[model samples]
Structures are given as C-alpha cells and as structure tokens.
Target: MKPWILGLTGGIGSGKTAVAQAFIDRGVHTVDADHAARWVVEPGRPALTKIVEHFGAEILQADGTLDRAALRQRIFAVPEERRWLEALLHPLIGQEIASVLAHAESPYAILVSPLLIESGQHRLTQRVLVVDAPEALQIERTMARDSANEEQVRAIVKAQADREERLRHAHDVLSNDRDLAWLDREVERLHTFYLSLRGGQA
Candidate 1:
C-alpha cells in the first residue's frame, strides 16, 4: 500500500527545499518531484531520447545531459513547448515518485513538489503543507539563486498558483518569510503534529 503522505509545496523560491530539508533533518523520508523530473531525463533514458528527438542535440550538454538552463529558456519563451515538455515528463515523474513512496518505511512520507497543486499531485497525499512567502521576496530569491533576470523570475512566479489559492487548499501553512531560526522551530512543531497524525490513523 502507498504510505501516508504529506504534500509539501510552494511557489518558486519560497524556500520549499529548506522546509523539506528540515523534515529530512528529523529523519523523514522525502520524495522530491523536481529530482524525479531530472531523473527521467538523464542521458540514455527514454524521456531524454524523446526530448532530443524533439528539441535536437542543442538541448543536451557536452556530457549528453539535458542542458537544463537552455531548455528552461526555450520553454519560458514558448508556452506550447512548456506544455509539451510537461506532458512528457509529468507521468514518468509521477510513476517514479509513487514507486518510492509506496515502499517507504517511514511513519509517513513527505512529497515535495513546486507544482503539487497545479499538476494535481496533491491527490497523492493525505494532507497539503504550503510554504509561503511574499511574491516580491520569491522573485528576489529566485533571481539571486538562479542568476535569472527579474522579468524571467517574475514570469515563473506568475505561472505558479498564487498565494491565496495555495492557502485555500493547504491543510497547514509554513510561513517562510522570516529567519531560518523561526523555520527551524516551526519544523519542530509540525514534525510533532505529523507524528501524532500517523498514530491517529493507526
């Protein structure tokens, strides 16, 4: 059977990885959708072969890996390309995530996905935990981390579910607009709560 799951999500640059790491620090088994997406496109993978056939060798690196930055730029410029890529990768990533989660021995597992709500991945979990930050802050963080321009970063943010929609679907919200010390404490608090939920389900 699939394990009990907590779907953790946020807008790009909302510190979803930080929150997921905190859960990992507590020894939770976590599956990341982004990581799964990359896995399906590794060199020699069927998805990678298809992407090469569609986008040409320019989409690949010298090492034959997907040139993620180049592909990101192309898709960002063309909505149709983005949709096509999503259609090809989403199902493969879902299968990989499901396989990992089903065998998870943890009391419960955490599924972290930036597109959890948008792609309907929340259906795989019993609960949704949203990591939220202001839009400006998300833009700033993405620019700093990705070396992306404000216009591009803002475009990515606009593509995600807005703050209110995420909150409306959230069973729990982790506000990450502040200090990491605060984040540390909040993770502790939520960790205890999730443990109790697993017990209750028993």
Candidate 2:
C-alpha cells in the first residue's frame, strides 16, 4: 500500500502537539516540522546564514546560537519579516521532512506543520487533519502554557489563519477544547480510521 502522509496543522496554541503525541503513542511515525525547522537552522546550517543575512547578527546569542526570542520579536513586529523568515525556513524544513518520509516504513505518517496551509507544503501530504479550538481558548492555552501575556499570545495567533480558514483546509477536524479523556478517545478513533484507510477498508 502507498503510505498515507497526513498533514496535521492548526493555529498556534491549538493543541496540535498533544494530538501529535497521541498519534505517537499509537506507534505512528510522526515528522514534526517544528523539530525539523529547529534542526535545520542550527548554528552552522545554510539556513542560518540566510537568516543572519536578512535579520542580522543581533539575532544570534552570545553563545552563537539563534536567539529565537529576538527573532520572534523582530518578525512579529514586521509582517514582511515573518514572511521572509518563513520562506527561508520552510523549504529547508520541507526538504528534511521529505527525506524522512522517503525512509518511513509505517503504513502512515503524520506530518505536524503549523504552517501547512500558509507555507503551501500541505501539497506534500495525502490529507489534511486540523486540530482546532476557539480563538479565546487558543489565547488562554498559549498564555498558560508559555506563561505569556494575552496580547503576546493573541499576536501570534493572529498571524495564523482563523478557525474557519483552518477548517476549510481540513479533510478531518478534531476539536480539542474538551477534556483529556475525550481527546484520547478522539485520537484512538482517528487512529483506527487511519489504519482502515491505509488498509483500503475505508
């Protein structure tokens, strides 16, 4: 059977990571774009060169590592800077993800990409799975998880597509505003459905 590559995405603070973790618990191979993005731009990577050229050396910390906080501050203040950063990192991350997918032996793999739609990389996958919650829930969760202020969380969420936009891209949607037990049940059901789909039984 051809491997099913599912693009899993959502707005920031949408609990997509939790859903990805659930898939991992079920033994599904997961290639997380966040991890890939971080990996590809480590101090010596070519992508880091591009970033330094565009954003300058100030984005580098005293340890010569990428200062993610500084980068976030710059990009969030200037929309075009965010776009430039995305353009620089997305391709590199996508390339690495494709390499991983090529060697994946699982019946299916979940590609966790926060920018699945915005980055236009969702085309690499067979289906889009959206993990969603309300904007208010998103802000609340982000604030709680990152210990960030409401305005900061809202700013990040605002950078992503709204709930409707994300919903429109989804082949399947999991609403994650409920309790953990409910989310677990939803993940189990989705896993079963994915297995069936891979087996040509769905």
Candidate 3:
C-alpha cells in the first residue's frame, strides 16, 4: 500500500514552506512542488528541451538553463501563455511526485505546493493541510522574503484564492502568526494526529 500523502498548501506568504520544514524536522518525507518543477527543467532534462522547443531558445540563459525570471514574467504578463506552460509542466511534475511517493519510507508524506488547490492537485492527497496567516501578515512576509514592493506583493496575493476559500479546502489548519514555539507545538500535535491516522501510536 502507498504511504498516506498529505497535500500542503497556502497563499503566497502563509508560511507553507515553514510548515513543510517543520514536518521534515519531525521525520516526515516531504516533496516540494517548486523543487520538483525546477528539477524537471534542469539543463539536460527532457522538460527543458520541450520548453525550449515551445518557447524558443530566447527563454534560455547564457548557461543554457531555463531563464526562470523571463519565463515568470512571460507567464504573468500573458494568461494564455501561463496556461500553456502549466499544461506542459504539471504532468511532468505530477509524474516526479508520484515516483518520489512510490519509494517513500515514512508513514506519511507531504506534497507541498503553493498552488496545490489552484492547480487541483489537492484531490490527489488523502488530507489537505493549510498554513494560514492574516492577509496583512501575508503581504508583509512576502515583501520581506522576496524583496518585493507592496504593489507586487498585493498583485501576487490577488492572483491567489482568498483566505476563506482556502480554509474551505483544509482538513487541518495551522495559524502561523504567533511565534516559533506556537508553531512547534502545533506541529507536534499534528505529528501525533498524523501518527494516529496512520495506525501508529507515536
């Protein structure tokens, strides 16, 4: 049987990355979608070749790596282009995530994706975990972490579903605004909860 897989998601700066890290610290096997996306497009990978064929070599950097900056700009500025790119990349990413999950040794595995809900990948998991924070805090965190200005942060946030909609999809929600200790406690609680779900007494 497959390990129980949890889909972890949240808005732009809702601390999903931190929550995933916390799970990893507790010995959970975590697969991050962003890393998988990057892996699929590495210099000599098949995905990179397909991207180059579709978008042309102009999107490649001098090092022959996909120019992520250019690609992001292209997709953000063009909705149709974004959809096209997503169609190309999502299947490849899904395949890699499946492969990783197939070999996972943990009782549960976390498939962390910023766009888990938006991309409908949430349906593939046994549980959906959301890391939540207030909108203002999300904006502030995004600005600080990405070195983005207020407008840019807001634009990014606007592109995502609102807090209420995300909450609707959550099988578990962890509020991350308080402090690391609070988060750690929540993580511990969830670790116990996950263990129980997996028929383990830990």
Highest lDDT: which candidate?
A: 1
- Report every candidate's CA lDDT: 0.89, 0.87, 0.87
Against the true structure, what is each candidate's TM-score? 0.85, 0.85, 0.92
Error of 1 at 156 (Å): 3.0
Off by over 4 Å in 1: 73-78, 143-152, 199-202
Clashes of each: 0, 0, 0
> Where is the poorest 10-residue window by lDDT in model 3?
193-202
Q: Is candidate 1 or candidate 3 better by lDDT?
A: 1
- True-vs-predicted CA distance for residue 90, candidate 1, Å: 0.7
Candidate 2, position 89, lDDT: 78
Candidate 2 residue 18 C-alpha distance from true site, Å: 1.4
**RMSD to the hidden true structure, all candidates:** 2.6, 2.6, 2.3
Rate residue 152 of model 1 by lDDT: 97
Candidate 3 lDDT at 94 equals 91
Q: How do the residues 71-102 of candidate 1 rate in per-residue lDDT, one tens digit apiece?
A: 99999899999999999988898898998888
- Model 2: lDDT to the true structure: 0.87
